[model samples]
Target: MKFTRAICIALVIVLVSSLDLTSAAVEEEIKVACVQTELIPCFVAAFIGSQPSAECCGKLKEQQSCLCGYIQNPTFGQFIKNSQNVFTASWHLEKMIIHVNLTQDNPMPLEAGRTVDLTYSVNWIPTDITFARRFDVYLDYPFFEHQIHWFSIFNSFMMVIFLTGLVSMILMRTLRNDYAKYAREDDDLESLERDVNEESGWKLVHGDVFRPPRGLVLLSAVVGTGAQLALLVLLVILMAIIGTLYVGRGAIVTTFIVCYALTSFISGYVSGGMYSRSGGKHWIKCMILTASLFPFLCFGIGFILNTIAIFYGSLAAIPFGTMVVVFVIWGFISFPLALLGTVVGRNWSGAPNNPCRVKTIPRPIPEKKWYLTPSVVSLMGGLLPFGSIFIEMYFVFTSFWNYKVYYVYGFMLLVFLILVVVTVCVTIVGTYFLLNAENYHWQWTSFFSAASTAVYVYLYSIYYYYVKTKMFGFFQTSFYFGYTLMFCLGLGILCGAVGFLGSNLFVRRIYRNIKCD
Candidate 1:
């Protein structure tokens, strides 16, 4: 989650999309700039309370109207980070003050060559006070500081909403109609006689649907870790929304690391309960695997990326102190909490129940067409989830790689919800189809079906590297792909868990309601 935290910080800091606005003909027409380049020197002098040079003064006077235009421009308004900075400054020192005496008490226009009397006062501040200032200053205020890609966000939302509604409508209508037909047929003697022969598909295989996946221990570990991560992310997002976090540059990273470390209890509980339900007695092994898998993977990837950052002398690199802190937090607080949760979960969890009893002999799965096969279904299953998120993903990629500003967390949170909804819907629908096709190996299928979204994410990342980003060099490329891989890995786990849980519940409910003999 450290890399995810880094990505999240990188996610909401800015929102500038890549656009090619300068054309050859437009460039040819502008002989001089709208704002004079020479005025920069004058602006610097004014910043330190000094008078402008003669040339600078001439430029300032010449561009006074243009300066006013720039100030009025909304795009230029962001240049001043905050107007309240004067009050917030650490020291209250007056560099200089001037007093003027006018002839009239009321405001009046100045006559040519009019004489005015002026008084001056100045206060000095100590070096210590000046050195204590921590806030940033900008030479010129920026435009569109809180800018969001509203159009893109809205478009993505509409598309996802349409797809989700269509899917839900189709599934509900079809399932309701089928349930009605099956119920009516149950009263007919002829239909009842034919059911045994007709039920050779899903009905015949109900016994195996609840069978534990082959790698139950590892799968349980993945699901638990993923569930913990999902909850951690949701909490962090809520914190940001409520302003508990979102303080500054490092806020997201700091909050994410702390929240994720503390949430290890969730992972332990989920893993222990799942392992117990699957009839596994090795609680310690389950706990170790659940706790270690993602952390080790993240640390390994982060270490490599940090080494690259150190090589390039980039501040983005995680410091030694920060790494030590993270390690200590994980080892001391997280591990202990996980152990406690594991014990509680093992004690609290009861024996598992299946809607239908399993037979002593396993049923053979009939042959499936290419389209109905697991590989094809898994590949196709990711499309909707990917579509729901691809637009938001582009913005996220732009923020990380292109050094753009992106402060649209609200939009990001919305997109995230839509992605989860889509992942669950598609995976459940896919699971239902696979079951009807007489394929009961749904455990891995459900996970891979939803986790397949990561494949598209990785593929799009490749496209972005070639088309969207002009980034070069071995270090930059490696860092991009390496962090991307981690991001995909985390995404897979999170999304796969969503699909697995949803499909698991759906299967249980449907089968439990059926009056099996």
Candidate 2:
């Protein structure tokens, strides 16, 4: 009886092993069938047409287990990882449907007896990855969270500290001596002459420094627009943080448009106050220009891009109804708010409060070294500010160009604050240098200095296009550069306004305590 039982147990073990091998072979065959017959043809046909057919769905349901096995297999993993949800649903016998809509207005016709194929691939193994964290497969964690990124932020913070210290030292030491000399009660002609001779730089141009800059209307408009843009960006960043705007289609853009319309008053107020203080008589023109300058520029670029999109029959083309809605929002809400703000600003803060009286005849600006010239100073002023936000720009470009979602608004906020500080410090220094060269044309110089930061950013975008992205063809290329140009324009204006405002305060403070004839 014991020998008979042992032989029976051995026979049972052999039968079980053979069944396991047979199951493995069946699974392999099923996987091959699923990939070749069910997945490839269905996915390709669905991509080319509107949606998958009933037969395609039935085949996918029948091969659900095989699909999961393929997902687990290293060789076929990439081809089917995205279909995990389908496999899971099918495994549980749940009803799930997927639809693919082709965006082309005029799709090419399929030739008789000809077949089309699509090769879809992904670089991820979802064995241990959760559905929520699936996007991590595409994110470049090493690039974004690298030590160099943190170091860049730290370096920018240090630069702010150093610049503030330098400016403070100038105020305490250098300016103190000048103040004591100018405020002295010495009635002696010789002493006064000596002090006058020593007071060559910056002090000589105090009278002309507060004079209205050339193109005053345009300057006021741009400054106001910049102020609005600054507010718009900050609001958008905050909302994105709170709302996870990246998860929703067109959420960020919708927020931006609404916020821009709401913030139109800022530009008007700033422009109006500056224009009024500068003794501008063309109030109507300034108000109109302030309200329309940026919007028109964007509209022009968008119009061109929209035309191209329509020509190509691409989904990127904006519908006429959407365009009309945007125009309505701008015309009714933005324009009126800007007008109201202008009126309020003119009434409230339009009074001139210059520390030094303007001379009837403009002071003759002496020739300075090339490096000290406004153009050169303007060009160089952007370098440090650009450096401050260089790393942040890489992340931003990647999020937009690549299929990555941007969720790091906290980092963005910090970088934005740093960019503001760095821009102000750099612009103030450039303005000081220009003023010390006996030039009173510091208004536009300060604006241009900060605005030049955008020039460098635009140049960086060019480099990224050629090196970091595989974007090709006329439509994609035109849209890429066009959108970048719009972004850079807004950035330039915002930085320019911040720089001017900071330097204006500095100029006022420095000139306030001095004796001016």
User: RMSDs, each prediction?
Assistant: 14.7, 12.4
lDDT against the true structure, per candidate, is 0.68, 0.77
Q: Candidate 2's residue-wise lDDT over 363-397, tens digit each?
A: 99988789999999999999999988998999899
Give the winner by lDDT: 2
Q: Taking the tens digit of each residue's C-alpha lDDT, what string does model 1 give over 365-468?
A: 88978888888889998998898788788877977788654555777788788788888888888888888788999888999999999999999999999999
Error of 2 at 363 (Å): 0.7
Give the worst 10-residue stretch by lDDT in candidate 1.
80-89
Error of 1 at 276 (Å): 1.9
Model 1 stretches astray by more than 4 angstroms: 1-173, 176-200, 244-247, 309-317
Best model number under TM-score? 2
